[model samples]
Target: MQNIWSIFKRELRAYFDSPIAYVVITVFLLFTGWYFTTYFFLAGQADLRVILGIIPFAFLIITPAITMRLISEERKTGTMELLVTMPIHDSSIIVGKYLAAVALLIAMILPTLVYGITVAFLGDMDYGPAIGGYLGFLFIGAAYLAIGTLGSSLTENQVVAFIISLLIMAAFYLMDKILIFIPNSMVSIVEYLAIVYHFQNISRGVIDTRDLVYYLTLISLALFLATRAMAARRKR
Candidate 1:
């Protein structure tokens, strides 16, 4: 436990001291801020409906960038070799790095609270929906980050990692719509497989156990794959 925490701190500090964290956070906040303010002023949407709709698109762009260098850069510069030799457990290292990425995401999300604040003062606002939406957003981010981590583990090139992760996300996001033209019976199964389908239900201010389970399952499965990838590298 302590070992995981130690590694987590090291990786988290690396993100903060390095420039990527700042760049990702600033860009994310800027885009989200723009969307929120624009919706409030121009579109006359007092709710954060616009921002919620924009999150998936924003994450498709940023999540890959965040995970692109997670493992690839470490291997590229020989740091992965050093990291693998540490006294900590294998799971600790993977969890540590993964948590660091999650932390950065949560931090970026922190600033978007201003949108909720703004909405609160404008009209009758239901906090339940807002909180549910944020929960859904966080889970979706976690699941995508897990996929990105697995994608990064599969390659030592950041560009390849980014492309692979983004491609996977795009496929998941479009899975629902792509199933529309399929046989009606098949669409139901396909929609269940689609990430956005579950996400949409949770995002609409309703917390469904199935949606929560879906995101958790995706996160767990991807992390398991990433762990296997790390073990294979260590064996090699």
Candidate 2:
């Protein structure tokens, strides 16, 4: 546990030392802020419907972009050897890296608060939905980051990692949309596996245990796959 915490702190600090993290966060916040102002204030009578909804869509790219190099960069520069040589467990490294990526995602998300503040200032606002919406967004981001981490572990090339993770995320992100076109017989099964189906329920400010479980299960599955991939690579 101590070793995991040590690695976690190190990984978190490493993010601040890199320009990519800053650039990604800045760009994400900038574009999202523009959309928020445009959709909610400039057009939609102070309703945050579009802005709240677009948060997770934005994460489909940013999460993978942040984690595309977590393991690939380590392998490219030979840092994986040093990391493996340390006393930490493989799970520790995976958790630390995954947590760091999620933290950066949270930071990128923090600036979106300005949009909420702006809406509140403009009119009467119930902040509960806004708060829950952001919570749901964070959990969704964590799950995506975990998937990105697993994708990174599976390949040593950053571009491949990004593409793999983006595909995985896209499948999950669009699962509900795709379900609409499928036959009625398969709708139940498809909804069972749909990420956005569950995400939408949460976005409406009700934190269902089933939805929370879905994200938790996805994160656990990704971590398990990442651990297996690292173990297999170590045997070579």
Q: Which candidate wins on lDDT?
A: 1
C-alpha RMSD for every candidate: 1.3, 1.4
Which residue runs does candidate 1 get wrong by more than 4 Å? Answer: none
Candidate 1 per-residue C-alpha lDDT over 35-134 given as tens digits, one digit per residue, 9 for 90 to 100 = 8888788888888778788887798889889888888888889888888887877777778888889999998888898888888999667787788778
Model 2 C-alpha lDDT per residue in residues 96-206, reported as the tens digit of each score = 888888888888888777777877888566676777788888888999999999999998999999999999999988878888699999998788677777777787888
Lowest lDDT 10-residue stretch of candidate 2:
39-48
At residue 6, give the lDDT of candidate 2.
81
| lDDT agreement of model 2 with the native | 0.84
